[model samples]
Target: MSTERRTKVLEVLKTAEVGASLLVKGWVRTKRQNKNVAFIALNDGSTINNLQLVADPNQIAEELLKLVTTGACIAAKGDIVASQGSGQSVEMHVKELEILGEADPEKYPLQPKKHSLEFLREIAYLRPRTNTFGAVYRIRHAMIFAVHKFFNDKEFLNIHTPIITASDAEGAGETFRVTSLDMDNLPKNEEGAIDYKQDFFDKETNLTVSGQLEGELAAMALGQIYTFGPTFRAENSNTTRHLAEFWMIEPEMAFFDADDNADLAEEMLQYLVQYALDNCQDDLKFLHDREVEENKNKKESERPELYLIDRLKFVVDNKFERVTYTDAIDILRNSKPNKKKKFKYLIDAWGADLQSEHERYLVEKHFKKPVILSDYPKDIKAFYMRQNDDGKTVAAMDILFPGIGEIIGGSQREERLDKLEQRMDEMGVPKEELWWYLDTRKFGSAPHSGYGLGFERMILFVTGMTNIRDVIPFPRTPGNAEF
Candidate 1:
């Protein structure tokens, strides 16, 4: 309870002078007590490593020491001393111990044992106390910081886009509707249609699917802007890749073409990977080992080609392979997988949309590195992508990684008002609803481009976690939102 500033376990482990008295407050990860002495491993979630506190059984009361079990919070003041331990270099000699919170040993689900990820999700509230989730969350924080740092270093302004909006930017037709009207007896017009005008926004509104459209408006004025925020989709997918809600990183820039956009994306991703290697060494090592252990039992063909750390470094050290969609289609069509009838959806046609199998094969087998497949056919892409001179393909690009199909999706936006309207009409994109967006092209639209990176998917790639749910703190999936 002293007024002196508390010392973190990370600081003490990294740089603490021996014989200096300090205080550390954290939950007791494990405690071993014999008649002679007790060794308590305390963690405050500051780092992946825990600080070992050596306490004399006589000095610290039995009542106090007994409560310092796993899942119990404790504050200890002690003197720093050199450790004879294997993993850690320093340990604390505890002079004072206080229990801030106590977890009943009978009811506490987390113990000094391994629990499957499925079991952990059942108790998501206490899952963070586990070693695996702890490392995951720490890396999650690191990625968040690096995202802002990456944009800020490029002099890109961070914009807070609205969470609630009326536009279905992706036109996915699946959204969580926000309303204050009575559902039992809803307001209906003369045509017996539910009148959304009586709702909160006086129009049909739902959680936004993408911030790129609004980010463009700001880019037209601010030159360059980025939005890193939560986005929602109401699809009924229950795969490892689908989430009802997730975070997205969307950056819009003026005077940048599709090539410039691809270059920036590659640089940004590599920078983040290098940043993690430099800063989060301990946590990365833990997750890397975790991945190795997870893949040990699988078939060789199903196993990852490289270790987690090697995979990350390979991505940073090598340049991504750039290939056109037409070229990629040719390769896939003539490749052994398609020829041997191994592909789930065989690459039989040129204009057909590429599935996850096709994308992963291109990255993992065909290129043996990250690949940027560009100039997709206009019919398959969104309406905002710029139409090419050939009139069949758009200036679109998708960055594909080994395990994941497409990590980043973006395009050089259709800046011409006439061309944009024509695409909108062809796709039946309700141009009247996006009149303000049309105004952007009518007034002062410059050659601009942007992309959206799924924050969790990248984290999945970075942490080498298989399930998309594990990377996020509390996953919002189809039927599960429990915390």
Candidate 2:
């Protein structure tokens, strides 16, 4: 192998200087051989597109060329040339080839053929090598960068919140506990209950379900802060929308109210959509076509109203319709679905929690655009949400999208210690557990607002992928944690 830098397939495809010596190394996607010539498609995760390598069997050993099958890794010294092929504009004329690794054709799970998403999930370690998942992951990475960039550009401090904490941010009681105690011989207190005091942290702790509480504390000091990290949920849900471990992007602004929070969330969503359209077109296009092919055979009623690229552009170009939860309830109650009993969870009352079907109907049918549903009932929302003048609803908002409902959920916080403590008591949440969180409200609390954007959900929208498991790599789900 040459001691020179390797040119990525992405760069190789864009090379203007033809006949330049280039060293490219990647796993072979496909290889076709004739009696005199052999062609190899190589990719190194630099791009979804592959670098076409042309080799002469007369020059390279037959045995060496035979090893360059599908899933084989190889290093090649070649010269970039204008391709005579129809698809790619340029190709590499390989002069020397080195087989770094070989995949036995008989044993390799993946071949040059189509595989179901379920089958691919079984072998997720190699799924990135596929066109569909490679595109998904590439877009995933672009969004990860875009997330940090969007926050950094707005001067929001990126805080690394603890994964393990003593408090459940959501107070839902569904949390994966983190303990260093023997189960067989558990320690007990005087009351004969399992004593958490003897645990590793000297108290009961679990994987954090959200970082918004701690993020709120930082926002109180830093003015604006965001936490982008993995959040866990112990709910045993195996649905398409849920995961045991997923990522969250929570951004808190100190001096912002409910309206300001909604505005910022809207701007961020538009910005992310625009960024993906501008920067990740190639990968997005691949996913777009893949989505199209996947949905083409389905009934017309079941297909998406707009394609992936079109929907992304629509989000960037249009303003989200802002509506109060009360008004939304009135609309839903009077809607045809509710009247005809089409909805599984009928919208009968004002305090009813809006289901995914209702949210989708509002965005896809009623609004015909993205929406910001605000002023949720106080009891339905978290204890931290600011109570409105009605005393029944909180200043909570949920941003609903076309295909996905409730892409983001945020609200203006209850800065007043009295109100917050009262709500905490009403919800039976022990204030003593989150002493640090309460300290922020007691000392220097401001009218802060924040929202959480599910990272995988964002990817689902951008990639037009139906299942949340496919967007995230190594999905942690109930009864499954396979690679």
What is the TM-score (0 to 1) of candidate 2? 0.97
For every model shown, what is its TM-score relative to the native structure? 0.97, 0.97
Angstrom error of the Cα, residue 104, model 1: value is: 1.1
| lDDT agreement with native, every candidate | 0.91, 0.91
- Candidate 1 displacement at residue 402 in angstroms: 1.1
Q: Cα lDDT of model 2 overall? A: 0.91
lDDT of each residue in 1-483, candidate 1, tens digit only: 645578998899889998889999988888888899899989888887899999999899999998988999989998998987776788999999988899998889998888899999888898888888998898888999999999999999998898899887567549998788998999999999999888989988889888888899999999999999999998888878778899999999999999999999999999989988888889999989988998899999988779989999999999999999999999999999899999999998889999888888889888999999999999999999999999899999999988877889999999999999999999999998899999999998799999999999999888888889888888899889987
